[model samples]
Target: MNKNGNIGVTSENIFPIIKKFLYSDHEIFLRELVSNAVDATQKLKTLASVGEFKGDLGDLTVHVKFDENTITISDRGIGMTAEEIDKYINQIAFSGAEEFVEKYKNDAAAIIGHFGLGFYSSFMVSKKVEIVTKSYKDAPAVKWSCDGTPTYTLEETEKADRGTDIILYIDDENKDFLNQQKIQELLTKYCRFLPVPIAFGKKQEWKDGKYVDTDEDNIINDTTPAWVRKPSELKDEDYIKFYHELYPMADDPLFWIHLNVDYPFHLTGILYFPRIKSNIDLHRNKIQLYCNQVFVTDSVEGIVPEFLTLLHGVIDSPDIPLNV
Candidate 1:
């Protein structure tokens, strides 16, 4: 079946709000898309663990690829059916750009992504966006596409895999995202410790004064980071190694704290205090926040106590609701 309709929102004013508000930090689109992919992959793992999914869980990794015109983020995770698309995409039940603007019109700082507007953030850089998806169920696959407008198209599509691919046709203004070096840097900063492996093109080597791709995949995340594991299972050297992994060029941390609380809210991470004889302000906001391993932001003033922002480390918790 094929379908076309306007996205069910009260206002067409949402697009302008997203472009104007999110323009200052539009690079976060990559993080939001990749984080959604990780969430899907992790959900599949959870289903498999609970004996709900009987099929083989294959290489559950996310891939980001770009050509001249489009950038595609693909994942071997639980995908959405056509109806799912209608519910999640076409419908606007949850809080969104419209509500966001209305609620925080007076206070700009209060304007964070509390609404589930992360997917819409693609409009900050893309002229058109597409989602090609095949659910793990036996249902048929589908493709949903939209310009930076209220109307969108949904149609049946043939897909050989059970996953989703978010394709963004880059706009003229956001051409910097097409560069390989720039994409690599963004991935490193935003998704280095994601739970699922993320592959961006292939391993490259310098040959004949130019970089060439190798046969191996250029996987970019640490699936089993130190923070996500049990403290008893790791040794002292493992902690040091993980610290260096997070901050490669910095001096060694003076000491560290392993947080693994699972009661009221599931929070697990490692806090490292570096030696600071002077310049205390320089070390503030070094802690990176993650939700189930996908990097949220280094500005973690909301989740952790205000005092803890002085420490440097990784804090990952699915419980903490992020505005971004």
Candidate 2:
């Protein structure tokens, strides 16, 4: 696994797979990487819940940082060993997410990755990618790297941590990702309500002449959004507050419904009845859909009833399918 070799592929080379996924939307790379990081952190929590892991789950926050040439996403989750890296990262057929779900079927939480392509999606916007990880089981840290090719390198590395760090070298064409404004917008759109707190940068405030960074971290998402909690635990003001968060300019909701169903399939959300001011067409697609708190789509034409789309609020379910 340490030597350079072509990535595991049955038919076509790795280049085609990158191109195939790239055509849909390269910005999706951010979502895939973030979701995978959340999944890893969740799996660690699940393991701890089942009494298999007793160590401290200290600071499980997923941190995303970017500079002119690189975007780094670091997670304090259950990292991979040398062999696990070879099997999961190097071997596409193994499908790490699917295997983990099946292996921990009785105890694991809902994972995001279905196909093994989530991690590889980085190649869509990157000329090179490197993974630095150390397992929670007292294994040595290892670094795995690959250019925009089939060949990859793996070797031992020094890392004073027990998680994974994914470093993506922004390609010349995808330099837009290097901009903090653009990255912040993408993070807000896709991960505003993720279960884990994502620290992108520092809170900013106007000082003498210009904006300056504060000591506090700028956490993007709300870990305990109202929708994820029980309706009984939330008050009327809570729903209204969440509604304003969703649509700031809109007036307060006339009424709301807390939908909670678990018998057939898991589902939980809040729907707000808003005052109809604009034309009916303007509110056609106000309902936002989520799967496991990750924003999936707003166009729920094929998934839900037509009339439901006119309402405002969120509809989340782990049963919903994800892109990668």
Candidate 3:
């Protein structure tokens, strides 16, 4: 049955507020959406690990693609039911503006919208947003769409995949997001070390005087990064290889330290003392931050001690509440 209803919002101006105030930058919408996909993929992994889902854990890759009118981010992860769409998408769960601000006050990338605003962040760049999803359970697929307003339409749909696809109808103001180069740059910046592989399109090659896509999908993320594995599993060359993955253009580090502690909060990573050629202050953002191997941000002054930001490396931990 098709359903139509108004999204539960305090005021009609809520969409504008989300566009202007909820996120500091429009590019952050990409990170929030991709992170949500990663969360879904991770949840499926957990379920399969516990033997709750007796299905093959197929290639759990998140994909980002765009055409002339829309940009679609699809993931082979656990999807939601129609009722879940009503609860999570149509409802505004946060109490008020004060509580929202207070909750994310310290987070620079803004907390993962735990208050339920992350999905809506798409409005900052899209005129209309669509979600076509099929749950792993034996439930009917669903399609939910909203056009930059409090009203939304929901209905049953046919989907062969067992995951979610978030489609954003690009707006004129945010047309830059439709560019392949821009999209690649954003993916590299925000999702280089994500736990799940992310494919933007396909690997391209020069053929017949034109660039053509090869058979391989252009997977953008490193699902198993150096920080997530044990120190014993990695040799000096392996560490160096991972370093080049993180910093492709930088020189090899002089020495590196591996941190693995699980007491108060889980933390594991490799810290490298790079050959600094410039002022110490210039190398502050050498370290990248990750939560459960999802690339959070390069700005780690808030998490890493100020004095320690001079070094180059990656830190992955679930304990650190990354606002990004």
Local accuracy by lDDT, each model: 0.85, 0.83, 0.83
Q: Every model's Cα RMSD, please?
A: 2.4, 5.9, 2.4
Task: Quote each prediction's TM-score.
Answer: 0.91, 0.90, 0.91
The superposed Cα distance between candidate 3 and the true structure at residue 268, in angstroms, equals 1.6
- Model number with the top lDDT: 1
Q: Tell me the tens digit of each residue's lDDT in model 1 across 63-93.
A: 9999999999999889999989998888764
So what's the TM-score on candidate 1?
A: 0.91
After superposing candidate 2 on the true structure, give the runs of residues whose Cα lies further than 4 Å from its correct spot. Answer: 94-114
lDDT for 210 in candidate 1 is: 100
Better of 2 and 3 by lDDT: 3
Residue-pair clashes per prediction, in order, are 0, 0, 0
